[model samples]
Target: MAEKQIVEQVLAAPSRYVQGKGAIESLGARLSEIGSTPLLVADDVVWGIVEEPLRRGFEEAGLPVTRVGFDSYATAAAVDELVEAIGSGGHDVIAGVGGGSVIDAAKAAGHLAGIRWASVPTAASSDAPTSALSVIYTAEGAFEEYRFFPKNPDLVLMDTQLVAGAPERFLIGGIGDALATWVEARATARAFAGTMVGDRPTRTGTALAKLSWEILWEHALDALEAVRSNTVTPALEAVTEANTLLSGLGFESGGLAAAHAIHNGLTAAPQTHGLTHGEKVNIGTLTQLVLEGAPARDIEDFIVFTTRVGLPNTLTEIGLSPQDTAELRAVAEAATAPGETIHNMPFPVTADAVLDALTTIEAISRRVRAAHGLAEPTPILTP
Candidate 1:
């Protein structure tokens, strides 16, 4: 057999990232840098919050703008609708303003339309803002596929005040999502797997992933406190940027392994429907640690971090019980499915191995929680 050739490495990122309080108030200037006419895509709720500033800024800058509401999931149909809505209007840019799904939809639409785009995240809930890919879901919210773009967003605009004013759960969710970057990147590096950017991990991606983990460990608690008070503090800013920018670039170019694969697999369980992406990834991180046979101290430290940030640290906390064997098996099978990034682990992974890891990690998490006097988590169930 012939040896396969691979690219050495790749690093990808948005061209511009601006973060600060009242950053959206400068939207017009930023838009002008890209295009004079931009299609603004946001949901009704987010539009209500940002409309005044967005319209005023554009007017002041003498830029023409078109507004459309993205009320559906990031489904193929939704992207098609967005494309049609863009129509023959001669829009030069697409700006997504809201949460992950809205940003994803906008990215997909922009890619299909062959236009540049920007991501304006109103909440620090996920690492989708700075990436060049979108997770498309079925209209009913089931995972469908990942859609990759030729380039990352042209701009990622973060309004710290808007983020801080969001409900604290969003920030906590972002922390949960950011938690897996280093662990997964390390595993991918060991396996020499190709990253989402279509090459080997670059030094920049590796450093960013490690630094993101360090920031979470050092600043997550303080950042959570700041969000609770609706105040923008240094800790809050650092964690928010770590969650969005660092984690975004890290995962895309550093690659993913079992943690994100497990998160995708977990979507098979209906009991997990109410949980956020980061929350599930947090549990997946614990499972990944156990799967890799990490040291007890390391697992314990991670559990403590998750607990402090109010992330689910156990199966029960994530709405699964020891007796849910069928669901567990489904998750394991899904995690180990063909094309899943679980194969990016240095070791060959099996569904049975994932099942065992899930069980063992839950037991370990319970022990850690008890030792730390943490209350048992009340499971979140979908109606």
Candidate 2:
């Protein structure tokens, strides 16, 4: 808000950025630019989807290649396994191919190996590819801490065909993740108005993050429908990029807040073990708005929109039972840490407030489910 604070936010760094339908084809050359070999990392399902085309591309470029597979995202265990595989495999360049988890693993492994890396996401999930940061998890898949880097991916790639074939849930989750940047960034800027942290968000960062949110809100419903129908409409493509690329940059450069805090709370609940990052964040975003004292009608609108698109709208939708009150309360309490999501809140947040919001959300969520007569809806949602 003050001139001094504005200056502090401008010092943040972001790296090279690129996107489009056929951008993946250039990865080989980009890898060359970064002096990286073609060491590909992907989830098991990814190979079944685009393995031949990718292998053929590297072969056509005459680049030596090595392959590594993971059972899940870039968890500590997966990273450990990849380190071993890469050590033995003698791969120099790393390419991440899949959704956020696969790309995240690739980035972490590539960084750990001290080699250049590229990213090829088959689903529009999170901005895991382009950022110079990684959300690390324990071997058992619990949140660890944020790992920041000086540089982002050496190369970034995407194939609309691959993304189009992904389940609609990924697109929905990605959109939710993307949209949170603007809301959270604004909240962060507001909180920093006269604080000791000063403002850590530049005008450019705030504007870009805001614009990304506007774009997502404008296209999300249509994009969700197109994704569900298995049709890659222009709207869907635009929204996907906005969420994955634009939002990723926004959160990293602009700063994140409570929605992300709530997302982090997922690790505290065993019942939420199978949730996707975006799915958890989707619900978390709603809770963040509630904690912000957002307009009741607007909060309800978000609830309906996310619910319609099959994003997780409730604790139950993401696999936690309404019966797990104590665990949920604990998570809410933990989420209110000063360094956690509270920094993004417009005012200093109390654990009691977070708990109240969480409680309210369960009521709203159950009411919505009742309207749809989706009785005995499976207590757990598939990630």
Candidate 3:
């Protein structure tokens, strides 16, 4: 194999993305382009919310769609089981209709089955709906490994009404995930790091990452407020797109850095299993900024905004304490483990440095909380 003179630029995303109220009602029509007999991947919880529209759509299209129950994390074993089950069912396509873990599991299973897959997110809880990679986890929910597919989902349909109907925590968590896009992308760009696509970031991917952040920075609070009132506004719509699509493409194509690496580190702690992916990633983003020696004002600004949106930034908030040296050290070690995206930082990263950065952010978070009289985030996660 000859070494290339330049790193190939990459920008990965779903082949098609559709978002609006009642978008899932059109799922049967859109998915027909990919396959006739499709498998719907969702758990009982998700099935309860989307069953009507999904069944109606398929029935109207005069097509057969089978349900694939998924309630666990996207573990390797789970993916293997799903692949075998799907192969036996003769499903030509798979469509995940739930949150991050379900979508990831569907993507992994569909890829292994050599069948196309679609994403039908009922909640904007994380940016997993449009990517080509499955973040496989352990049965206990610890970070396991990443499974990549040949392409992104064939269709990504985000029903804003359904997203709005979900518990507000989902949207908040999604915002947290979207917030990391720009921060991680900036670092990846700074270091010219490799992406999930096995290539360097493109200008287009970086631009989308920046846009995702800007959208959240502008509309997150408003979107949260609207969700609290059980209403879907323009702010909510914009935020949903930012969290689902922009962040998905940005992280996959633009590359990841310490933020996501730190999130994986958090998974090493069992106490944090209840927290959503975006919540952990939000904490990771703050830690990454600290590790980078970013401007104090920038860090404080992030704290201020995220605090208002209820992102947990302190050790205690995430079920860790400053006194828990062993656990914290474990997290630091995981963040700096071999092949972790923390290496994407322009500077060499060590577990000790990551540990120090975590401590620094705790103090910074405390200071910001005191100055603003802000309360710690409530409802750490949703069911």
Candidate 4:
């Protein structure tokens, strides 16, 4: 008899997660449990929003806090600078406050410094807060690479009032990100592919992915509507949890297939640089559905939810048209590059498949938009 293949199942998540209105009020005490001294990595914009509450909380807890600034992108040089600051400041823990880039830098810095970190996201823009990996970008804001750590964050604190107060686009973008967890997890499980931890998916991980999916479909629209009115409704709370905790756990443990790989590939086109990570990921998810030959109803349902949430359902909305063949091909090539998660598909994938799926999604999105009486956006990078 042939020897059986031994496949291990792995799951990863932050040690602790707290979410609610005024959750930042306890940031100091919560962080103190991890370490006494904390260094905050946040940009000026985020500092403007969170400074008073965070500082007051830390002061009330009698914990000394140091601060550092990060702009929009998490560059390697930025990580190095933060590592230096942590060392020189004798800081025991890190508090990353802002969007994905700022938090990603804090995670990378804390990992390098051999200290734990807390994620305090002001906006629900992406799922970078709870993952062990950081998406590094060029200083000019192009994709560079990912920096991974041996472990996830020590804690993740989301102040939903703060999130609800931010632009509704941020919440919608997070929904774009969380929407992929189940689709990709389903793909990975069917293929028996490895996850971020370099092992197969666990039943627990897959379950979380499915849960994330159901939560989004149920509550995403209500959450966006609540955010539009700057209210912390229960829908917003549930979507926030789905976007950060469940999506983070789901993607890391359940595995990524083509959606995120395609997001990375979209980065190769300078035309796409202006788009947000979740915006591009949404289109990539649609393209992935096409590449995998998903049911027509599934594809249409995805487009409906995506458009209703004000996310881009077509590549045309971001940039590029089939007329820009060279760039689209470049995107396809990058997506299928060796070691990309596109290979995690149940069946083999080719650059041609990726390229064709790209154009196909654009066509389908146009039809859906017409049905909804929404006009197609002008191609942003048309020659």
Q: What is candidate 4's lDDT per residue for 69-92, written digit by digit as tens?
A: 887578899999999999999998
Clashes of 1: 0
Worst 10 residues of 3 by lDDT: 374-383
Cα deviation in Å at residue 169, candidate 3? 0.7
Tell me the spans in candidate 4 whose CA falls farther than 4 Å from its real position. 1-6, 378-383
Q: Comparing 1 and 2 by lDDT, which wins?
A: 1
Candidate 2 regions exceeding 4 Å error are: 1-7, 11-15, 84-91, 193-199, 321-323, 365-383
Candidate 4 scores a C-alpha RMSD against the true structure in Å of 2.0
Candidate no. 3 TM-score: 0.97
Q: Would you list the clashing residue pairs of candidate 1?
A: none
Q: lDDT for model 1, on a 0 to 1 scale? A: 0.89
- Residue 140's lDDT within candidate 4 is 78
What TM-score would every model get versus the actual structure? 0.97, 0.88, 0.97, 0.96
* Models, CA RMSD each: 1.5, 3.8, 1.8, 2.0
Cand. 4 Cα-lDDT? 0.88
